[model samples]
Target: MSHAPTHVTCSDVSFEWPDGTPVLDGFHWAVGPGRTGLIGLNGCGKSTLLKLVAGELRPTTGQISVAGSIGYLPQDVTLATGARVDEVLGIRATRAALHAIEAGEATEANFAALGDDWDVEERALATLDQLGLAGIDLDRTVGELSGGEGVLLRLAALLLARPDVLLLDEPTNNLDLRARRRLYAAVASWTGVMVLVSHDRELLDRVDQIADLRDGEVRWYGGNFADYEDMLAGEQEAAERMVRVAEGDVQRQKRELAEAQVKLARRKRYGQKMYENKREPKIVMGARKRAAQESAGKHRIMHAEKLTEARERLDQAVEAVRDDAEIRIDLPATQVPPGRRVLTATDLRLAHGAAVAGVWEVRGPERIALVGGNGSGKTTLLRTIAGLVPPTSGEALTHVPTRYLPQRLDVLDDESTVAENVARFAPHATNNVIRARLAHFLFRGARADRAAGTLSGGERFRAALAALLLAEPAPQLLMLDEPTNNLDLASVRQLTDALESYEGALLVASHDVPFLESIGITRWLLLDGELRSTTAEEVRESRWED
Candidate 1:
């Protein structure tokens, strides 16, 4: 993967939104042959850089060049609901042309359309299968497929295009475990110039190198995500040591400056005494006074300059240390007793009559991982349990106070500030208390006053998560569906840290097994047309299949 040559170049590129929000400024990046993982914080230009490289969005200034054909898969793929699978795969025309030629009515245009690509249908189906999209028939509409399947279908289209350069943005965002494996395999097999932007740690670990896009510049780490982390850890440790050394220098300079001032004061006093006592000739005394004064002034200036330089060095050294703050949540109200009944469901069935069968229950603070394949109604089940919708023929009852954070994250009122949103959730709590809790989530002071709508993806997720968890009356049962969908690595870590502090029952429906494990999942349940208990190992091995 690391053996390929450079295939892309961006020279002095700059981009910003129409509202003049700057994303990139004079950014220059070169895409070499091999897989490169582009990663950064949520608001950073990872996605935007991918777009610029793919020519989907032109740079506001400068130029970008790609050596060959490009195939791009965007983060948020919007498929035409009525469009057929084959149509979305971009082979409908070729298929139709091939069929026409087979029907003995081969027109010139039909033959031209099918030129050299007679096996397009076979290739399309093969690519779809490669991405774990085999069961989906060509006639099936986009609306029929699950969210994960739709993403895979888009990827299949890109693969079918067979471009020299491939750009994928969060390709594994909605994929199930099995689907993720398939995608990972595809990524590993990719040998061309591939620039992938994702927060999926597993996917990033497969890259040849890491392209960290932060503050509009790309820093290359010559290895996968794990290598980048190791290198960064070393760099941070060294930076911290430098900061300590710099701090000592600043303090020493300050002390020397203070001592110099004392000496100058004493000299001034001695000079006054010499003049008052008339200890020498008037000219000699006057000359000595002037010389002493000049020396004192020079000494003061030199000491002051030294202190300023030391402080400046200290500031630069401090800047080298990255601030990777983790969320610290302590909600005593969310705690539940070990023997308490948190949730109970009897003869559970979905509104669509999909397979949600038998008793579904959560006792005490059980952290359950609701695992299943794509389109298995996990979201619907979670929503049903949360009382967002009524079950078709069963009842889901929460014995304890409950809250749900849906995938759409519409819980936050966009017009309100973060503080206002939290206030809405925790109305009984005082503003000071609410803000104090928010500070743990890294929203401090004026940041708490920013409107939710203006927040970046990670910030919005944090706000929504904060609001859901901090709801009034203290939720004892928390349901989250695809909570890690758009979170960056830091946000994901913060979410994990916050979950560690949660004492409530958790039912998180996510394909993120590593994340689920990190949060200490006590039980794993596979959801299909029916629900049944499963072990973590089985859940992983079978892809949550029955």
Candidate 2:
């Protein structure tokens, strides 16, 4: 019998960027042979930690020890412009293997040099089949592959490496629903120690443990995403208690300092009278002066040093115990009237250049999730609805106002300013109003004047949202295409909060289960040959935490 390896360990770890902002501090964790979901908002150092564990980055302090070989697949895809798909996979450990094979040096040393064993190429082919790349020519250039297809191909190649530990960063971001389901199932059944960072709540629920990174600290929770949610409530309550206790101590110290000052002043006044009176005895006056001096000296020392230290401590305690700190940005009001059936589509079908067709039927005021496997036409349906693409057959009716926020914020003019983008959407709105609305979304003053192209993904999303709300009649029918992509955790939360309150029909096509859940999606349309209504059970049962 063999035991599972204790894969990765980090002790007394801390990290900081060049600007001196701390990302992680005093973080310690031990990952064994199991699935671990690393959960955190964007830029909380989730990806940074993954890179550190993969040995791609060095920690500013402390030690990281890995038990064996590790494979990491980043959320973003990196493709060599002119390289072939099969060529990319072969290059991974093949140069030496091929050299040995070509040199007629067929030995155990050569075979082991390629990987742990000789069948590396065979394993790669099988992995390629698993990713739906079996029949395709492996020698095709990567530049010829579609964006979505390339992502899958690279992922398959990475999986073939058969590493002891796998670090996946938002692995499901660009995948369709079917592909996502398959990926989720694969992750849940994998034997190695798998650490994944994802915003999808469904994925989080399948993991054995969840490590929530927040405020430069890791809060370990046993069980799945649902368990972590319950634990989070308790943690928030405890943090509040700490804040209350610190505040009470602060008040008590203020009172003590006031009382001490009064006593010191009285002693000084009495001593002066005794020293000035000619009839007073020399011994009494001398004693009075000495007592006064000692009292004043002691009071000064206590008030300046000890009392000051107490106050400083109180401040630190209060700072450490923040309870309700979250993203709370004010967005511009759309105030669009809820009219009858802003959008309606029935018996709708879509295809990818006459290849794969998707089924769909959606009604207004109904929150519908278009779900299917990879190449299932989720985007095709969205494009058809947005009028970017014409449906092959079926009727799509728009009764009232409508607006769309695409998955790619390409509608934005990169060369334009943030204010200019808003103005373009609502040409009638005055400059002052546009600026005010932009400020509400946390784009204030000089920041609003910055070029739109230079803004971070989160900022760009916020700006586009601002532009959308500024549209005339403020579309009651809002369509979002993967709106949460590239947004930070705080920004995602803010976006969710905004959508939750919007009193309009929402039609969103997204793989982000948590974001969907947050906004309360009721109906689901599975993109098969035709639209099929999905119950909550179907979704809950099939959706696994990554």
Candidate 3:
């Protein structure tokens, strides 16, 4: 499909916080027509770059230029719950004008507002339906919609504007599987310039190309996320090969230099012996001595230069290879014996609805996926199961110790350091033990001393996960709610690694299907007013209309 050409250019842009925390320095990135997935590790300035382009934040040192109109959807969209859908869609005045004209009270002001388009409402409804929001009352208040619906509503507003450029930051973070598929369709149908920032693998796979932003620079790769991975793998393989070659060259240079020094020493001894025996005239002997010394100096300099060049090549080769640190924590204490009952729910009636059909039980190390539409009580159900809130009618119980990591990541104390937070969970463990375990989470030394409130989103996630998993007595039944929301793709992998080592019954409430699959969920349950058994296949195909 052909698309209108739009350009977003960042030239020598640099931005730093007021406290002198550097984010981007001399960063240069550019994107034109077609969807571009802006990706990198967490804390790599992906969102900051998008904000700068959207004019929400200004570059400290350089300039950003865009050649077309822009529509920006931020990560956390805040809307007034009391506002009407028409008001949020920015069509209230236009609707009012249409009404006045129909009432035979059309004035010049009303005509100006109405313009030439008489099918605006019809078009709005079509747009809503295209985004899987069909039949939604345009006059309904924002509070009536679910969280996922609210996000889509905001997107619908942007679609109505029909801007030349679109930027969406973590657009699918709050969306469930069905909602995500609808969003994916919308993105796929976009025929204009789009800069999408997200860690959602399925979403990234739809982009035309991938622009990896790292160390304040962008490395472009043609095609989608899978293509980018293939190209990167090839590059890494070549880099490792070059590193081996450089190492061999360095060793060879060192050996050659040593051999040259040994030969020079032997010549010096022979010359001294010849001088003592008066084998030649004194002038000839002095001439031979000067030539020998000059030759030795030149040889030494040449070998030194060769060695330096080899080492430099090695350094460059090493930098080309990525050494992503994986999270590895031993959780032997969390192990559960087969047939051991980990948790049970008896006639559980969530605060949102009626009592469930039967007694729910999780035994052994069963990993369960709790999923449903927004406002379907996924988070609320998990919270109730964790004992944070009481059920409306029945009870939920856990025989083993449990830990719940909420979507907000509120496990850490804002005032305390990362180490202190972990220590809070493991009160009986020594400082040395806590710090050592934090290192596995990539929080080492002074990093462990940083206050939880001061950490970046990624750092804060690591700190919270460490604290929860390493808590005293080791939680044998772990429950997580939207655990991968704030993480980057790499961090998600690390999370998978950490969970792989866990040997307990796990109940995760998340919309990330790939991550759910990666962690090896043994069961799936859909919680829409009531929880029911489901399969991974059914979960992917199931649709829950808001």
TM-score of each: 0.95, 0.74, 0.95
Report RMSD (Å) for each prediction in the order shown. 2.2, 5.8, 2.2
Off by more than 4 A, model 1:
1-6, 354-358
**Residue pairs clashing, model 1:** 355-529
Lowest lDDT sum, 10 consecutive residues, model 3, at: 537-546
Candidate 3 lDDT tens digits, 155-206 = 9999998888999999998997878988999999998899999999999999
Encode model 2's per-residue lDDT on 1-546: one tens digit a residue. 124465799999998988887878888878888889987665578889998998888899999998877878887888997987667775544656757876998877667666544565567667766765665565678887766567777777667666788888887788765456667776877788889987776677789999877777777899988898788778767767766776776677777778888888887787777678755888877876887788788877776675577677767766655332333444234333433446667656565632222423334456766555555566776777778888777756666567888888887899999999989988998999888877767788998898999786777888888788667666667788888777755678768766755666777877666677778887775655555666555654544211
Which is the leading candidate under lDDT? 3
Ranking by TM-score: 1, 3, 2
Winner of 1 and 2 under lDDT: 1
- lDDT assessment of candidate 1: 0.88
Across 151-255, the per-residue lDDT of candidate 1 in tens digits comes to 999899888887889999999988888888999999999979899988898899999999888767888999999999999999999999999999999999999
* Residue-level error in angstroms, candidate 2, position 493: 2.9
Report clash pairs, candidate 2: 42-489, 178-372, 178-373, 203-545, 203-546
- Stretches of model 2 off by over 4 angstroms after superposition: 1-6, 9-32, 52-65, 78-152, 213-222, 262-290, 300-310, 322-339, 344-365, 384-401, 411-460, 470-473, 487-490, 529-534, 539-546
- Of the two candidates 2 and 3, the one with more favorable TM-score, higher being better, is 3
The predicted structure with the larger lDDT, 1 or 3, is: 3
TM-score between model 2 and native? 0.74
Q: In model 1, which range of ten residues has the least summed lDDT?
A: 1-10
Top candidate by TM-score: 1
